[model samples]
Target: MSEDLIDEDEGPKKRVLSNSQVLGFVMRLWLRRPVLLAAAVGLMLVAIGFDLALPHAARMLVDAVTAGPANADAAWAAWALFVGVYLAFTVIRNIAFRFWNPLASRNMKELTDEAFKKVQSFSADWHADNFAGATVRKLTRAMWGYDQVSDAVVLWLGPAFLVLFGLSVMMILRWPAVGLFSLLAVTAYVATTLLMNKYYTRPANLKSVALDSRIGGALADAVSSNPTVRAFGAEAREEARIAEVSDAWRAAALKTWTRFMDVGLIQNVLLVILQAGLTGLLLRQWQAGRASPGDVAFAITSFMLMSGYLRNVGENIRMLQRGLDDVEDVANFARQAPQVRDVAGARPFAGELGEIVFDKVTFRYKSADEPIYQDFSLRIRPGERVALVGPTGAGKSTFVKLIQRLYDVQGGRILIDAQDIAHVDQGSLRRAIAVVPQDPALFHRTIAENIGYARPEATLAEIELAARRARAHEFIARLPRGYETLVGERGVKLSGGERQRVAIARAFLADAPILVLDEATSSLDVETERQVQAAMEELMVGRTTIVIAHRLSTIRSADRILVFDDGRIVEEGRHAELVGRGGAYARLHAVTQGAAE
Candidate 1:
């Protein structure tokens, strides 16, 4: 797998959380449903009490049988008690799970929802550096990992250790030596498992989990760009690349599994020592007449109880460790606050005037060596139409980004309608600005849903009006499903120009005070481009509009044309005035004109 896709040192993983923090994250969710948690814990205690009683009941039954023929009634009574205790334990344990299962499932549901919402809230730069496929893998894996951890904590960890300790104490009260051995043996077994899982198997498991995320990311990257691969006939290349990642995953996973198996050998050896030593100690007591046959029976039964719980404890330790490792990334995500966040007591974006101002704004991308804008000041009055012209990476797109508050400036501030954008609710601020990108992205939903996304409350009649205005209603009406048609992932089912028109319709529905178009007609054919162009002119009316264009002719009629070079405005004028001056805009126009001819 590519290091860029899943490297923990980069992007979101820069704030890696420890295992304990992950455990706490899971605990907080469990703590939310206190009633169910209490019920589960109480039932577990009841089940353990019944389990401990079984061995004592076995002693009474054995003694009753060995007493005499007259003791038959006594034997029958003890036998019934034994079976009843066993039955109660089985039923109670299952009932406890009934409580536990729902508690776990609900937490899983909330965890996934919270994780997705956080991912959505991340800054654009964060999303740019992370992989969608990898993020999905972590979120889904964390859910199951959470379930595993909760299961061990409620079912195995709580009951296994408690039952083992009770059995040990019970044995020690009768024969101090035998009880002491049982206690030490089980303690040593649990301790060894924890140490081995923590120090040995954990590292390997973490590597395997990371590789798993990478495989998901690699597959998503390839499949999402499958059309491009087909066009270039690179299916074989993609196959080989995926195979390389799969092979790495296989190696890491195999190593981790074998380490677990290796650790199991130690647990089996410890159980054997406990079994042999306990039975041997009982035989010594019997030979000295200090222990009866019933005592022997009790000792054997206690060892059996110890054996089962000891095994579960070892497995539970490994499971808990692995679960925590899988959950680490998501817990970190929760702890690492979003880079772009609303201020405390932030108000909604104010005013409908569509006035934008950049006051001495100094900004740079985290990954860039130099600032994009330094002490930059600009103002666009309400209802002004401004065109930005610049080469790639000359800060044209960033100008619009700053207006939308996608990234905050390191120095100074941006204001929308006299309100500092950083001091406003991001949702309200964005709702007042509509953006149409050069390459528009749409959901795999009905065309109506996609257009209505900008304004969820829009009625079908309103959607149709917007689509017709954007010249999209005619093509959409011809589809078999009309407005209800599903536009595949990212609108792949529609042509490029059709997708752009749908995007335009969405923007039209937004009805925001400020409009931004990033080469909106870049995808359309000449005829449709002209139609949408005229429609866009109408859409620009009464709105503060900023257009970024490479085709100089498209913005020739802009109220003001600002030619950006590096981070400064090198030329500011209308098309004729700028062309006559022969500056940066003039050279671009000359180049464009030569290419067209």
Candidate 2:
């Protein structure tokens, strides 16, 4: 939601992934069901062989008819056998397709799921440096490309290869010169396809996809912050920017397709030349009585089939390149190493020691020029109530985040109950601490569901109790659907105060040993804040609590007040002591009092 989180500057262009990497990505999915893949391949090969043999059957029927009217029975029998073979392989081909499609579909689902999980696992730095829209678009396109490439390899290109091989063999058996010519034409088509794809389609398609992602990111960035855009009257500018990018995308697409068209034209011309030459040669041979009528028919069928096959080869190669281009974006994103990961042999945190110690910690945000905290050490005793009073960007939120292991410290250790967090399982470490941020985001779900999010297994009665404690139950009960009312995206259907109450209820439901109140009541009205304050007071009875607040009035009862300035604890004492001392905390508190008056 922060402007800093939207990375607008386009970095260096992404290089297309190697064909081998793309193939490896595709092939790895087959490893999941090797038997199915093998069966499919075997069946496909047999089917392709039978399909190619149909042309030979035609040749055989022509030869049988040309032999004499006495061989009519033989011709009819041959035709019947050909029909039976065709029907058999059609059944086999359908079965092979049935098995292969599921494998491809399942593979695609797994890949997309893995990428989504990986994105969620990524550190704050990775997210902050990437655009959410661009990342999502890349993942979507990558998944689609994965599906296309898988289908092309297993369904299109795979069969094409077998068909071509079988056709070549059949041609050679009929005429050695024709077989060699067909093979040469195929070889040339493939070479041209590879060269053209490498130099033209790959780069062009990559540019096109890149532009599309940028447009997607830009559109999302503009639309998500609709309130800001509308308030600032920047709608026209946003639309113009989108149009510019979209036009560029169109141009890029056209360039790639135009190159494909050129390649197609070249292929068509080459095929025509090959066809003409082969047909003329066959006719001359037939005139000299060196070739039979069957040979002529076979030559025509083979050339027609080879022409289409060669065209498809070009198309498949382009598809492979396009797939590689699309996946390259997501692969780059997934390759980002998570900054915080569970250490080897790490154990889940247990118990409620409720003690947190920052031992000579050093930390800085990725985008910041200087460390927010360096050689900073602090200790909060079990059930201690500490208030962190600081100006914006004084490292208050960062401290809480580090304690929860949302981001690890750059140097030194953050220990919970004397156990180093970095050495413990992240999930367990977070489980011990519950955070209620200033702007708590809620999913679009029922009020009860949102409140029970932290403890998914909590019963309705338990949820209602937590809501009552947070002063949220009465309002929820008043809604038409009561607790079942749908909170629209980010809980926008609810007022700020209601959303805050739901967040408080969620925290109450969590009941963790340590609590972080990051200006939790900042959005509530004075009356609601008072009620929530009472609830928080009750919840804090036996928990180690860290309260980050700018409003000094809220922390009057805190046992100790820490005044942070420039990442250092400039002043620390009880609220009354700091007020009497007339130091940093006293000055900050005075500003709040003055502003209130």
Candidate 3:
């Protein structure tokens, strides 16, 4: 598997976000849990208040001491009050954080789960066009990113306001020069943090995108080429490819981290400058007799408070950048439009499906520009057994896809029971039809569970009966675990014939009015194919059956045979009549028979 499939190269692009827009997006999810948000906000405010009060308590202790040597009792009383108040605030802050962290984590988990559920509801075409690994990365990032928003709100914004409020109080009560110097230090710290962040944000975001692409590409390629890798004995080669991609990812990550550490270094330097300047100013004021020893102590306390708050502010800025990157990935996923969407006011289909009509229908794969089928038309009557026989790109699969409404026709309409399929709800349409593809895929589950997937609530007896009808029960019973035998991933534990039999059992269990077998029995040997074909004949007794097959012998008994060339049906009739006509069907039948000989 090529690494590019999972993680393609995407260049750095500036994300567009006004402050109001970003805030609005964040608030939308938070507001959904009003009580939790309110509680978090209240706790944050309480924490901030306690933090701000600590600096005031220190100032009070200083003022009491400065009243003169005879005021020793008052100083002792002030010291005791300050210690008690500070301890109470510390306890309160810890308690608030305990309440806040859990609420934030829970909300984030719920929001991500909701997004995943929405993704699952999309149709097959959506999955085909989008990489599964990329989607997983987006969901994971979204959940973890919400925590960054919480940190910014509670740790950064809250502490910043508290520090500013504390500084204001000190300026009023203490020496003016000391207070002025303390404010200047705060300004310098904020300025340096912001400037560093501006340089770091873009690179960090690009690194995230690159990492997502690398992981996604590796996973996609590994899964898509599992058979080839195993067959060619290229496991070592695949491992080397994965290692190369991992190395590229590590390089990108290190670049981002280095930039982030540089920002941290700059922040620390500014903090040192601020603390030293404040300390020097306070000592000068005390020497000049403009401030007492206790007043100088208060100035030191104020500097510590400012430093703690500014450090938190810097941390929050870093967190905010990470949160933005995560949200961008989520936004990219959420903004994806489903390749096929239901029409407005689409209603559920009711009653039996009659003639299915395709009028000038057209379609093409996502990577293809030209339509695979152009101006294609077909009318299949109720209970008609139609075999669509064609060469590999002759639009046989595309025709079946249109009938199931997996992808809407690009040029015209497909009608079921005289009503446009697009107007009916997809669930209802699919419920009336059953499909068994060429290579049947089974989930990693028990034999009974695989058969019961078409009808999850099917009883054990019902499953057994369906299996018997599909000639699969005899083989299933012989297994060590009987019906409970695990099928392994994609039914790799079973032979090709057994897997097709299981798929046939599923179709029998579905009991839908329309049955589609797209090379459904291609895997079976001659003897097994005969038995499975017999079972299919019985199951198709009262259903509209559409079979796509290359083997003419399997489809020879179909009520109507539609022979396709390129993207158009060149001939249509019964087996004997078509063979007698010496047209496309007859010529293909001759070729197949010759190959068999």
Candidate 4:
């Protein structure tokens, strides 16, 4: 991987999202499954209602018993009502979870799918700029973060708030002083937690999360480059690098967790104050003969309920913070607009004639100080075989990418069969052209799958035919499981020549009107290249072909050869004419005569 590709720049990292933003994002997903969400939420409300009936029932029972043995039946009825309410609450909460669990899981899956789709839609350069492993870590972590967020909202915070509100209302209706104290304590506790978390804990937690992502990226980078590590005997150096990152994460995580404990301690003290104040208020009311024993019992029961609910709320708040931190990465991903976007109402590219035209085009990379191509124009007629001859960093690859509309030109239009590529759907445009890159990377799948990837609907017979046409079937036949053999990651199990042939076979299977050969045979040996070149000659007969020639001698038979330097076409002619003219192409041929031939 290039140094520029691993963009783990921490200084300009993503901003942290607020609770509402995170929850609102989740709620939007829930709205998609309206019935399930409604059922779950409705059940939670019913459960809270049943649970709130208990303290009132306790009050009723105390009053009934205080009226003496004449009220024994009423006392028993109150006790029975309380137990029934308790059981009802338990059942409804369980039912709520049944609905909530599936909804959470489904939404997590959908969120992941949506994030992956957005990442895929990002430009090739955007992908190069980000760490692949870090992106994976964010996607996976955010999925679980959403699960925690959903749990905090539906299971803990929602019920806790409802219980607090209901209990506080009942207290206010019976004992004003106690109710006011309870409300004040809760408000103070929540405020303190929010303030401390925002100022003290959040920075540490965010840093730890960033380092954790770096660790994932580091591991992926090292492991993927294991061959290089072993060749250079840099195992210890790699371990030290990992330890350095891991140690930073450890310190940050410790500080973040300790900050939570600090906040927890303060909230617990406030809880104690709340309990003491309520007890003192109840005693004063009773001593003044202004409150009955039943009222005192209700006060005690409500205090217990409020205390437990408040504690739960405090814990849920902490969980919510952790979830918010984790989800911030993916949320930012959604916020960043894609570098390349299709025009509105873009039509599918309908192609049978492969005539390609670049008319008055101008293009430059964002990082580049100068434009790569300015007002550059060219046209390749249908069934023409055109070869681009140039040193690297010239406009050859960009030319191919432009035709596929990978990056939109700043000015002018690129067209295929007279249809403007920028105005066509990307997938449809790319499907009309087949590209075999210089360094062909394959998925870790069977040879058959690799070849069939170009056309998933291709039959086994069709795959074999394509493979034979590209001279890949001979070596594949010698493999242990033939087409069923799994190529290791990026086809590491195969030689470079083998991978290149497989790529060519895939192009053969594509059956597109246009074909791009980006140094296609550069990986092959002399004998293999001869065989593959023979096959390519047959394949190029009826298609408009663009070859980014690595070996200049190989393109002598092209209908026309273009010599490129910097960003412009310096010379254009047949091979003999250009050689006889003793210009740029002839100079290039003379310089590389031994190696190119």
Candidate 5:
């Protein structure tokens, strides 16, 4: 396992990325096409500039109207020019928005795709530690949140700053009182939002985490425990459990909603106070002959514009907080170091796989305190059919996993063809081996597709040939759609025996030099097991076969049998020799024979 797989002792500290860091990461990917980003920013600036100029033009018109008849024509012409500039700004902004929005969407899609690939590349151990639904939610939420941030920066924030700055300049020019009022309103809005965020942000994040946990737990439970639920006729019980979780999620959502509503109320009250103060100041100025009706009208218009911008700023702040939380959640997964990463410059395995040697191998799952195997060693030569016989929890299955490199050993080296498997490219090593797990996991795809998954480019004839070799073609041909029949989720549509056959067919098609079968015929009836055993024997003829069997009859013809007890190999020999010796293997064989009788 890599060093990063172990959890740190710092406790959860709201693993957040700063706005600048987020922007930098986005730009690193987006700025590769500088022309697009530059054009988008340029058009936004032009739009803001034109939007800012309108308020000033309104103020100029007010001044001109108050000055006398000589300024009437100039005021009307100024209004017309303002209208023209505003329209041009709208057009340019729309054009720029059209170009930038799609690019941002595309960038988000690429990021999502890359994150998904990284998740798929993660070792099985990582999957065991994390929930699948939560990982998916994180990826989706991050992509969406990144898009919102982009929109806020380019569209919402840009326009808001333009309006605020313009109002400040105009207030200074014609009505200083209104300018101060607008600034105070902005300050109040910012303060209120910041305060609300301080109280609500953590809860909101906790709510999201709780909701994700509920979802992941429910999904995993429903799928994995369907058999138990059905057998016990507990559908209503399961539904009630789901409803309970759903209610909790809804209550959490309401808590967040209530906080948001409070923020909105506070903002509305602040806006009313600021507007009333500005209006009173304007009236006093008008009474003193310091301002005109037109000046009051301009101030009111600027306040309306600024008020709308300020409201959006408030909304964006809330979204920005949530976005950061989402991004952090997703980045956590993307940034996770794999537990079983290959060494630098790993090489591919070349030449025939001669012998697999386990040199004092030891392993333990991440959650376990004690190792499964301690100072254990085993060696099997090429073309050896070795049956590993052991009681439950004797580490037989773990041995198979170690050989496949699904998990790295904690101590000692595993050698394949006299070279350390750790030094081999993971892909090449996996390609050289095939495993038929005790519980075969099939995809939700067609029969042919599932078998062909091992070699996607295999011809239909090749698939049929492999199926025949695995004793699956006969049953497949009888299905309604034959090779095209969909297996449904986890091959639920097929019998356990049939699913095992499909798994065997996949292994047959893969044609790896090293094959591992973990109770491959355990699910089959006697007649079916006989047929599958024949096919398996033929397939194992020229390969290194590691068979884990509870039924000693299936492994009776093996060249060697290793009896395991408490993670150690207690006995090793052919079935006849072991039986003659009357050791662990003989006792195990007797127990199995008695059970069968």
Candidate 6:
């Protein structure tokens, strides 16, 4: 995450960003490409200068013809010069557009990359609350919005103003009254544009963008939850829910366009009246011999140019508002802070991980009232095989999470080999531990890719060896595509046992010194479980291991068993010792054993 994106006192709740701030953020990206943008703007102005000069040339031709045979040669020469300049700038305009577009595209790409990296750096809790679809939509729209705004401002709006400025100079030199009216018209148009955009167009555009985000989120939720909808035969209900969001989006779209068009109507009416009234007054001046025929020609041409300028200004203002909304969306995502961060001057873990100690650790979830662990302390010796046995909600999984620094403890500290875990780099600490979860999550990628995920550079032979050790190679070999078969999202295409085997294979490939098995074999049948248990035994050799035991039979050979109740250790001993004592572990073990029988 970049320092500029952070607010020292930022909270989980979103901060309302102002329009100037959002626009300023986007302009920073543009500032990085100053040379390219400046050249483009220069070329654009040259083109506008030509456009402004053409009208004066037309006026000169008109006055020369009115001057009769005396000015015929000068009139023909002026006409020829005008045609040549027009052709020259026609080529220049083409070149400028070609050069400018690529720079805008490059700027957009750079901004997208920065925004994506920022989003990935956010904490897990922030991601959990923010929908993936909405985030994706925001990113997509932000890049596109930058492109649209660049075109509206640099290519059209800026050039239009240049033409107006040049024309105002010519109008004043030719006729004072016309020049005064021209300046007033420009001021009125600008004021009206600013007023309409702020009061009506901008708010409507923001509402529409919010609706688009909601619609996208709803669609993503329904599609990802397809299995749930189909299992209950509620396809129609799901469709209706999506329809509800889509209808709202439609209404928002209608409202935005209606407001924009209504404002546009008033602006066009004002321009028409100004042009008509100005032309009539100029015509009378020409009839009275106070103004030349050329002055009347200049007046008509300038009015037409002003009309075009007004239209482009209105369009750009709307585009500018839409772009601002997109910038706000991406900026909000970038502002979220990662909950777990390395301490100052954090270094990489050194050498081997010999032991782990939870020293007076206290922890609680953000939403929970009571602490899950209150001053909890524990120590695990090097290469010890320990099993944690308890009912659900006993803080087994959370212990693993804290060990991995997925979340930090609220009080005290955890140490590994006498080094505090919080004082080391997060990536280094996580790389030392391997976890095989009960229900492993996989990407929509090939089977081999999933197996080699922990060690991406693993060779085919190494992957096969890991698969064989996990007792997964035989089934994989029989599949149509073997290791190349695509596992649907979350490995849904595979059976429960297959997914477990794949996860185990990934762990085998990882070969980390500290291993965690959270009911790793719970998903398999009795026969498959026995085979996997043998493989797990081999994998655990000479490694510090912690197992969250659901099936008591699997932990019989563990060197130590810690029985938990209500988030505290109730008993600690060998399985045989616990059973003989007839304590909480014994009663729980007996219940599990009887159920299996």
Candidate whose lDDT is highest: 1
Give me the overall lDDT of model 3.
0.77
Q: Which ten residues in a row have the lowest lDDT in candidate 2?
A: 1-10
Clashes of 4: 0
- Backbone clash count for every predicted candidate, in the order shown: 0, 0, 4, 0, 0, 0
Per-residue lDDT of 374-467 in model 1, one digit per residue for the tens?
9999999999999999899989999998888889899998988999999999999999998988888999999999999999999999999999
Task: Please give the lDDT score at residue 393 for candidate 6.
Answer: 88
Query: Can you write out model 5's per-residue Cα lDDT over 53-83, one digit (the tens) per residue?
Result: 7665676777777778888898888778768
For model 6 the local lDDT of residue 25 reads 75
Model 5 regions lying over 4 Å from their true place: 1-33, 60-76, 173-177, 223-227
TM-scores of all candidate predictions against the true structure: 0.97, 0.94, 0.89, 0.94, 0.91, 0.91
Model 5 Cα shift for residue 543 (angstroms): 1.1
- 114: Cα error in model 1, Å: 1.0
Cα displacement (angstroms), candidate 3, residue 122, comes to: 4.8
For every candidate, C-alpha RMSD to the true structure in Å: 2.5, 3.5, 4.1, 3.4, 3.7, 3.7
TM-score for model 5?
0.91
lDDT of each: 0.89, 0.81, 0.77, 0.85, 0.79, 0.82
C-alpha-based local distance difference test score of model 2: 0.81
Summarize candidate 2's per-residue lDDT along 1-597 as a digit string, tens digits: 011122223543343456676667667767898988888888888788777877777678778889898999988987786687679779989988888878878888888998898888878766776677888888999898887787677777777777776787766776778777777767777778788788766667767878888887888888777878899998898889889888988998899889888888887787887788778878887998998998888778777777777777778777877776777666655555677788899999975968989899999877789999999999989989999988888888888878878887789888889998888888887878888888888898999999998899999999999999888899999999999999987888898878888988998899999999989887779987887788788878889999999888989999888888889999998988888988888788889999999
Model 6 lDDT on a 0 to 1 scale: 0.82
On residues 404-429, what C-alpha lDDT tens digit does candidate 4 reach at each position?
Answer: 88898999888899999888889988
Tell me the lDDT of model 4 at 293: 82
